[model samples]
Target: MELTDLAPLARSSIGFDRLLKLLEGSRLPEPADDYPPYNIEKTGQDAYRITLAVAGFGPDDLDIILQPNLLAVSGKKADSEARGKGFLYQGMIQRPFRRVFHLADYVQVRGAELKDGMLVIDLAREIPDAMKPRRIEIAGGQARPAQIDTGHGG
Candidate 1:
């Protein structure tokens, strides 16, 4: 499944091109709709966290890699070496899978932890001082005067 020309017109903005690409790439290899369920949360103005339900997966079975602007999560459950017991009905899942998430500009993966059969991935975004919203001070009674520099070179 892919997002059809996802918000193309957004390119009119100054720095939305990269965002489009990130969205596009993340959609390429759709993460398995199954396996450990996950949730993405926005904690602060620039902080985010992804929680995954990895019931039978242990810390050693999971791997998190951060490269440049890409964050990838992968989990591989160890195969069982038990005898085939008589079971008319069996309902258990044990498969390996990988999920990739593209991080936007200034977004960084902080860390990941497992607790209560849940895997949590932490992310944070830090905007530069100049980029963050700022209020321009208005002088009470100040008029800016422009000086015209005429090049008078012989």
Candidate 2:
């Protein structure tokens, strides 16, 4: 299903303007550009993991960048390594690729690692103490009236 209009939902929401904007501006990846398949999984209540199948990419050939609320993962084979390698089938893709992910508020990149031909990226949402829910202590019992002190030695 496709979402065409979000104006009605945006008008009724209070603090979801950013979310609505993001949804409206979101675009699916091109069907023909499905290279280096990836998976995103929720590991914990506030933790997430993104695993990409980078079969021919090494640690030095990949770069993970985090900026504001964006995460970009890119990989490119070295010119020296790609040259003089005449393959019979050439099934493995060694071309440069860049993938970007939009992160939610307070979500941060914890770390990343390349293991078993998979690039694993770890993320966690850490809400600040000031933004967390807190109980308000309500004062009970009798109320006291304050006396007003006027000027002119009153």
Candidate 3:
């Protein structure tokens, strides 16, 4: 099913303005370039992993940066290294690429590693204690009895 607009739904929901805004913003046109395919998987309840197929790129050629709720992954081969590569049948993609990801609140990048021509980036959602759901103790209607001093005079 295709989602056209969420304005009506946003009007009915409470405290979901940001979520609807994100959904609406995602409907915008995406980049035409599909270089360096990637996958995002949920490893755990709050853990996630993003793996990119960077066959022709290495650790030095790739850069991952995180700012606020944005994540950018870019790769570019060195000028000297890119030169002297004369290929008759060029099938592998070696061009520079930049991919940006919109992260949710409290989502942080834990680490990244490159192995077997794939770049893996680890992420986790760390909700603060104050933001987590907590149980509130309900007090009963019964009141405690007051203690009277029946001391020395009595």
Candidate 4:
């Protein structure tokens, strides 16, 4: 319903500003449109898939963009004289639409495909080598005693 107040967290935290901003942005209500419905699914441990029902759209009519932290998908029918022709009862919607997806860190677009009136976008989270968890070998021996040498001649 409402965004939680994060001003107190902002004061104590250093790099959580982005999270706070995301939460604030989500609080704003957006117009609900069921047109061009979509589904997000998890295919693998670190892989995801987004499928959109694009009945009349072709590959050329769609555009997919990858921003720093967002994935945007848009569709626009190409201009043509035939499209202007009058139709008795047009039920299918060919209007342009844009959809955005917020991505977490390290998430990247793998590929996309259009099949049987459905557009599928694949994503995978590939963590960098430096950031992945690694095992550290701990020392496995007892501490050695310090050697002492007495002064030679008094």
lDDT of 2 by residue, 1-154 (tens): 5658777888788998778877877754445786778999999999999999999899999999998789999999999888868777787887899998899989999999999899999999999999999999999998898877877684
RMSD of 4: 3.9
Identify the runs in model 1 with alpha carbons over 4 angstroms from their true place.
1-17, 22-32, 80-90, 129-154
TM-score of each: 0.63, 0.83, 0.78, 0.83
Angstrom error at residue 148, model 1: 12
| lDDT of every model, 2 decimals | 0.77, 0.89, 0.91, 0.90
Candidate 1 to native Cα RMSD, angstroms: 5.2
Candidate 1 structure, TM-score to reference: 0.63
* Winner by lDDT between candidate 4 and candidate 3: 3
lDDT of 4 by residue, 1-154 (tens): 6558878888898988778889888888877976689999999999999999998899999999999779999998876833686888878888889999999889999999999999999999999999999999998888889877787755
Candidates sorted by TM-score, descending order?
4, 2, 3, 1
Candidate 2, poorest ten consecutive residues by summed lDDT: 25-34
lDDT comparison, 2 vs 3, better candidate: 3
What tens digits encode model 1's per-residue C-alpha lDDT throughout 1-154? Answer: 5468666567566767776766666677754476666788999888999998887678988999888678888988655521345557656554677777777777888888999888998999877888989898977876788977788754
Off-target runs (Cα >4 Å) in candidate 3 are: 1-5, 8-17, 143-154
Could you tell me which 10 consecutive residues in candidate 3 have the lowest summed lDDT? 1-10
Model 3 TM-score, all chains together: 0.78
lDDT of 2: 0.89
